[model samples]
Target: MTTTRTVNRAARIVLPGVVAGVLAASALAGSPAHAADEEVPGLHLVTLTGPGTSATPPVTGAPDAQAVLLARQDAVLETIGGPATAYRWTTALNGFAVELTADQVTALESNDDVAAIEANTVRPMAGHVDLSAVRFSRSSDPRASRGAGGSGVVIGFVDSGIAPDSPLFSEVRGLGETRAGFSGTCSPGEGWPASTCNRKVVGAGWWVEGFGPDRIRSSESLSALDVVGHGTQVASVAAGNSDVSVLMNGRTMTSFSGVAPQAKVAPYKACWAAPDPADDGCSTADLVSAIDQATADGVDVLNVAVAGPTTTDTVERALLGAAEADIVVVGAAGNGRSAFAAHASPWVTTVGAARGNTLRGRVSVVGGPAFTGASRSRRQLGPVALVLGADVAADGAPTEDARRCLPGSLDARQVAGRAVACLRGGIGRVDKSEAVALADGVAMVLVNDRPGALVDDFHTVPTVQLSVADGTRLTRWMKRHDRTTVRLAGVGIEKDASEAARWSAPGDDRASLLKPDVVALGEGVLGAVPDAWALFSGTSAASARASGVAALLRAKHGHWSASVVRSVLTTTARPLAGTSTLVQGAGRVRASLPRPGLALDIAPTRYRDALEDVSWEDLNVSSIIMRGGGTTTRRVTNLGTRAEYFSVSARGFVRHRVRTTPVALRLGPGESASVRITVTGGGNPSRFDDGWIVWRGARGSHTRIPVAISR
Candidate 1:
């Protein structure tokens, strides 16, 4: 759990980019720009292509393939007689989702058994974790304190549901059974019953017919529980139930766990919570029906956490049919430091969001000045009386809404028993510490008028936050001290106050590959939510700890495939340091892996021919971009055993030249090798270059990969 590494210099991507056939465009078909076919109303979807398609249930010879895709969606609704259907989708896609009408979406775009239709939109919700800050890998078996590694994998969690009485989700002792091609179950709805799925939450569903039961809001939950706490804090950061503890306002504070704390959690739910509880969404036909019910419930790592599609939609062809059925999805690279990152479908594994070292709180001030910040408030106040939330407004409020403590705009006799300070934006930061604990304030400092990531959250009182130069030096020492004082203190851990995260989201030169295929830790992490345990921060909690490190590498390589577990977590990441490669791409996310003795895998029919070809810069990916200075080729294989060799070395092209035809390699065990590389100079075409190639294995074992280049 140490990790420092440092390098920083990877941000350029503003070119004449994104034209190479835009993922072979053409998925969301017509209807909206009308003025004549006039019938346009709502809810759509469609999707069906070739071979009796439906998606999940027994689909090979199409065993009644969702009743032959519902008799080809009731023969396109009895030849445009329209009106009935509202959902069908076989497994993760084969599709239907009804209620259209711009002349039945221009007659299902001249139906050839429709391959795309459109009109479903809604998406939102994306937002946890720390398992030894990603050094991850534990499990020396003494039952390793009850399986510390992800035993039989599982991990589905589409989003927004699951609290099944959180004790971080107990019952995981030895975690043995449950794996025979899992078929997923647990349905019980409304407060989530079905005995709340035991064995660490085995399964649980939810959908909402593409989020529309009149926009939910009858206090949420039509079942799979999680009354808006981001799917029980992203299924407790992917597979909860381990050391647990972590409380907060009721004390406790630390013992966490998850990142495969013995994996197995299914969830599903597909996001909801709207009537403005700060809005929430999800519906691309309920995320392609919860990715075709977690790919017909055989789940083995999915965790989308919303906002995907950079092209070929229908939720990126249901995450390319959940990575051609071997699963391992993991998405969310969206939060916005000027947007760009958001699951650009390279068969997912996107991630992004970093800023390690956390747990803060401190604050100080007595004769003025101390700092620290973020915090899960472990209480302790002292020399209190600090004031300034615009000096406690309330009566006639709006002094900038009592300096941003908006809720009721302060002034409980100048914030009772003192502390206040406020000012951060207008709303949430735990609602300005619940408007300074509803004006009976006893703490809260907040501050930040820009300059990002401080967030430890879970507050109700004793908080801290700050930054923006320590909130302008405590608002200029409380406008040049008259009384002031302060304190708060207590909490702990600190270090990385910042390194990437102005809302982590930058990877867009329109894809030739090199998206947020990595980066983790994600701001203040912590996890579990319903029955308490908080502190979140986004990239959907680094896509649920990269789907708990792809369920602890599919519970120890049970024949690794979803593109060799995304090329062994993008060539064994660990690159960060002042970020680039369009903001932390192949970096930070080390679950102690390092043994990709060479891999690259790809095939989902070459990602459906790079989504129907213009050649996605030759896709055998392990992160290499080259955009302007090109020449590609890859291959690899030989995942370890006898006759090894390697040698290669490239290390950060800086201005590019990189040639690589054979710098040395031997292979033999399961043999395979190719290489080629190229990348000429790097002069302009919109700058931005990156590095790392490495290989080096004569038994000191190494792999690395990464590489980038702009023009």
Candidate 2:
């Protein structure tokens, strides 16, 4: 189980004007001078008092700043007994990550120069995009032409390495010049070479420890390339050039395009291939090094497709530095099906997964309901004898195995001329279908084991998957009749509005702050693999799509601040139905050129020890209500040059009980205004209710602030 620190309501801090308030409150409350030593062992991040302001650390090469930080580092080493290898310096945070014993941490905390010490938390990889969904296509938004599909912008991927030779990264397709700000280089080692760096793929490097050169190879291929295929897929989703095509199932021709086709890419291979090709592992050391280099190289957008536990050490500090430098950083929300830690940092835009278009084979019972399922089989079968696997298990096979259609568990004689009905769970979906094929079954009917949404999967035989409820009925009917039959149709692609992927992680960090800032198309997203095309899923793909959108925004509005770019994407997102802010966040990211109407920018909450403390929440109105009512304020700044008229109205289930003061406002160009939102109890207090506070402008530009009310 993962442990988290709970912060009390008194510690809640609002943004814009709460900095001084929090400081005053802390001082008046007379908080303890020193925190009790948690005594947790492992690498710990030790922050020291720097000579500059908290918001901006001294420049990387400043002589005076370096001297002060070096002195502080020596003092920490003296107390912790480090031979320099015991810790690593993160110049951006003026801190060092050192492996220390509990006693050493206690001793270091006592040092006058040491500001804070936190255990280096482990972050797991969180494991993309449709350009049309985000208005990146030329047909959807004319502004796409203005940026030349995000030319001149550099997007850096800090995950698995990319396939350097993929046609998607060809410079002839208009991959523009490398930005002058980037100074990173391609360090050739093992199977990787300097030629991997090109005009389109501007930089390539890897950082791994403990594992020697031989262990660096991906599980699938022997080289520094993306043997896991994830890096290649994600990188292509973000910035691959146009006219890409995939020969699906070896026959279907499917054309593919990235969100920002003209953006430059920098591959920073920070993760190492795990024994299992499906899972890639990354260390805090390699990740931080990659981030430091990516930032120094001046990448405009950083797309991290990995997730892990929230850490106050190396990862957070590097991300903070990137944010301070105005880089739009995107990360995954994990695949754990719950709120995750690594993507909890406020400085990063945490993305969740949503459904995209998929190809599936339609299945229908002779006298039952039809269902949609995925299968790679091209054959169409009709009115075949369908027998449940449980009814024909081999005498010596385990009953559970028979039900799951495990290999060698079924009686071949009984299943040879019939279609097998297999229960889901206990094994891979594809494996089950393969087992049926091994048993000589004519077709397979896979039943979902649980409720909620279902993702399509490839199968070895003609197969159709049904929902749990539907599958239960079918099984009962088959048992009673003993002569059930079904039909399987040819495969076809199915497209629908994006829905939150069931596997995407949920959020409300330890501090009750909303995470997964947005959701995007990630399920079954087709993108480049080393020399071919394959469909990839996970929050990693969604984050890449978001990073690509950020690149497009940056290329078009080169003058906009990173915060503004984030604001535009979040505020303008299309909210998914039947999902909450915790699941979908600000909603699916959308992109468009700046318009003349109301464009609002709300600042994020600032904390005194933000980099060292991992307990801060983003500055939105998502709050828990203890009393019958609670009030929060937000400052909205207009970026348009003309006076904009807007009306504020609360919409959604909880809206009826919530009211905003000053329901109307007219602001001049570059003007700022404030509004107070009060939520009152009118429904069940035990249940959570959510709604949006929408500021609709007269000119059709809409901005929203999500509000959550809970007891």
Candidate 3:
């Protein structure tokens, strides 16, 4: 590559504040420069690794050169230092090797020298969330109790088409559009499929001709519909308005709501519509075309709750173009904690997850022969709870058993004071906690899963998570240790960054922005499914809700740019770290719209408030020179007639930047008054020369003028 091209690539720099926040935390994994081991003693300046190590090792044929096999992974990138170089892939080389270009690596893959390939999605965000809903929520206001408008907006759910009869989508089109046999064809999460996923679906695509002339297509040429119920779940969450009397959990529930219930759904068959879950590859070209189709159809939003390797920069530019056209894009975060993903393009709002923090808990345990001493052995040395199958077991979800409230409702008087035992099925760990909080005796919620062994159950009570085997054993041992199943209570916080589901991607992208965003109440979330009202979890559901919120925001703020949406979210979002780190850009997002009466807009600066400064929840004292026994105070001249409402928030500078508590205030037009601020709760700020106070109006736009707390 020419130095000019390289310079241009680096020069086209536009890093969002959030990205900057994360990049600041990104310690060079090794080095940005290439230094031979001889030059940097003890340091191995070596060229290693390649992309797409799916089935076998990728072979590279570099004759007459010292070839060194580096680690293996998907996504190949190279950095050159003088004559020395570095590679970002794994290969089998008998001798040391020099760095090469991405195209070089691709060419190597085609050669016979390659041994294994790279499969992205290996990063982990352990104990994290699902990002599906994260990006959407971040795009909109998570706090808005009511939506502004959702009609006319279109979110192309590129998964399965909606079930034509789904009550949840009563207000939507393409409901209950299903095809037969779209399931169980995906490689068992272990296959080298380019993008292997579990939740498949079925449906017809107007986007793709079905049987007409030139309509017939094959797996290589067609997008699969929803093979599993995932697409429906995502679509419903984004726009479900359920038909008939709301029947949720076997009862007449309220009408199900989505992030954008009124938004039109443009179903794109990215997958097959039957159990033959078409192993359709989502190549760069195909994704770009889909974006084009959505744009042409005037899709206001697009929900892509998918996980794939970072090999497709082709679609990224398209995503940027979509944003330019005012389309809101949302996707899943991931499940694992150890992995990282930096795919949150500045133009695209990336999402994460957070589980249902409501008050319902469950513990599913099987009795009878399943728990008998004879069965105990089988249960103990058991079937790995590889995946929860719509059940309440630990290793797996409860089949028909996962429920919110038992058929024979527990008497409030009887169970109010006692803890509840609703198994960890339908009722999510967090929500169950809230539910038990309601029952008088439901002192605590104990969750016991079925007897499998792989996956571990999560809880929100004095929460005890167990393997399927232990969970099964606990059923018979219930009387002991208060139902040897153990108690589950609460995990203190809840945000819509469901990081649990998104962690499915393969190789580590080495980018926190590319990894799982957060977690949500997926295991069992009470929502309107296709045929009936059911519960489901995954990054996909979260992504839907997030998209819905974005729709609301887009509707509310016509002409609001994507950056503005992202700005509002990251700026107003709660900082997650005790100190600002590279990983958690902003703290958990307030997935609702800003309150109508409060407005906050401020950037970090050095100054002091005089009115005791109590309302300023967080600030840097070093920056603010507190004069005398004065309090932290701000003078505001009301610019609006009558009274103007706004909220005050300040952030501390430096690492651990802390935002001050919002001091509610009303300013009369032409009135100049001093407002006191305080330090409520948030991360600490140690990086600023001074802390700052900001004004956010009810309109949710910040009067981001920095107010310094003085010494």
Candidate 4:
């Protein structure tokens, strides 16, 4: 677990002119970017590495010259020529100074000798979805609830592109549909292209010369618009409108709602076949251009439902690339009744769907294989806590809404200390503030938000996110039955199952690391969905709800980084009270947590040196092969001058097995990139054995070092 992180100048090698500038700056104090006035020289921060090969040259011929010492970065090499093998003279020319333009820097990196490059800085998510505990926090509309989709946050739904103006959904008419094409399978013919969209109009595709695998489109792509309703459903969950109404029972009833109702949603549309009885989504190439387009636009959170199988290498790169540009990439954990860890990468947050997203929850507790007869009863003995904020109004006034909905658990004269409900719904201190206000006299308050979604909370006393259905019933039953002693005890279901939700995709990405981050109302959680209102579902909603909490946390820890948000959310998540490890990763996400230490300056042990000369060192393994059989020994060199660590992880390989201990790695001074991989040399060399060697750390970057393990 040793990784080399690139440190800022002083640790990095300083190039010539930079050295002169530094000398000049030293000559007149310590300012470089602007020191030319008082006899001081203007210095720039930079790093240089090699495997270099240019027809021309650099400010310094051999990248390892003294001029490289002034950049003030570190000692690890950032760029390289190709994957290094034993005895390949891998040198990390770091901490150099240069006067090169952004383009010049690119050209210098073009050399055949640069292996990997490290950066001095990193991007931190502050006003956006913390990809880590990403709960869809809700926002009060000046009307309903405030969760993750805060009023100002911009979450872009960039799929086959959003048909915002489509006639199919121009005015909201149920769901839309698409026509299926033919030409399925992995291949077509000798001269035919492996295009997911075939020229034919058959169920699978047009007539192929011979026969091959078939072709299909996304459920939303059935016709063109979201005829099938996947896209719109996802959108609604992210930012839907919520409205409350009274049910026939004369009892107050609520419906499912989106995480954020007013947060502007931009749809980057693309066209792909959905998964059905006959096919899965299209190839990876189909979405690459779309992702690139989104990145360029600098979108914040990106929801991807039609993710490729863990087997798709190109697709993985696309995911990594999106992260490099600061895009929060999210997707559904496959529906495969299986599990893996690939999706749990620090850069990506994988979500699962709750079978029922209805705000009017219809919770089902599966009895032993046979026991079908169980009596249903109202919960009693608990303080009736009302949910406040945006889960109640516009701008997330859950507390206000809670108060207005039911002045008191009992009549005002009898309602001395009733429990108030709260969630991390986005309106800053709304959830906690609401709870505290409600728990005025009573001893405790029921947390009405999902602990499994986001960690937004104000610990005024006691609370947790009970199922909306459970909470409502518990609160109402208490006011009706418990006149004297409030029963925190109710006959209801707590998260009591080992089954993964349907929207949760199954996993097989041991390389990427996958797991059910958590679960929440995704199917039809009632609330708001834009224009008017509708029930929304999906982990997206959960995250939106979580976002609501995050907003509160943001207020609590104004200086905290995205990692901090994730750390608190995951660490505080209630461990699943079940048997299997699949249903909930660390447990359901919790809304309240005792502050970690006192200072919000979170330095998660895993992030000791998040941005530095990232490299994989001391890698050793064995293998047995024949003719084309052999092991590729890749030696990563920290050409940078600093002594730190960087991120080291790889993915998307067929028979070529890959593994990295500790997930994160640290590298010392003068380190080298080394990996003793035992790969079989018995595949179609161009495809199977050829996989991408990714190096991602500081620079908000990712490098796909294509390696021919069998060359």
> Highest lDDT, which number?
1
Q: Estimate, for each residue in 350-428, the C-alpha lDDT of model 4 and write its tens digit.
A: 5554443111112121220111111112332243433332233323334444443222222322234554333323333
TM-score of each: 0.34, 0.74, 0.46, 0.38
Candidate ordering by lDDT (highest first): 1, 2, 3, 4
Q: For each candidate, how many residue pairs have backbone atoms clashing (under 3 Å)?
A: 13, 11, 271, 216
Model 1's TM-score against the true structure: 0.34
Candidates sorted by TM-score, descending order? Answer: 2, 3, 4, 1
How big is the positional error of residue 90 in model 3, measured in Å on the Cα after superposition? 35
In model 3, which runs have C-alpha deviations exceeding 4 angstroms?
Answer: 1-148, 171-225, 242-250, 253-255, 273-285, 309-312, 358-523, 528-530, 574-584, 595-711
- For candidate 1, the per-residue lDDT at 554 reads 77
lDDT of 1 at 370: 84
Candidate 1 minimal-lDDT segment of 10 residues: 23-32
lDDT of 2 by residue, 507-568 (tens): 75333455677888866666776555555566788888999998988887787766677766
CA-only RMSD, every prediction: 23.4, 9.6, 17.6, 23.5
Highest-TM-score candidate: 2
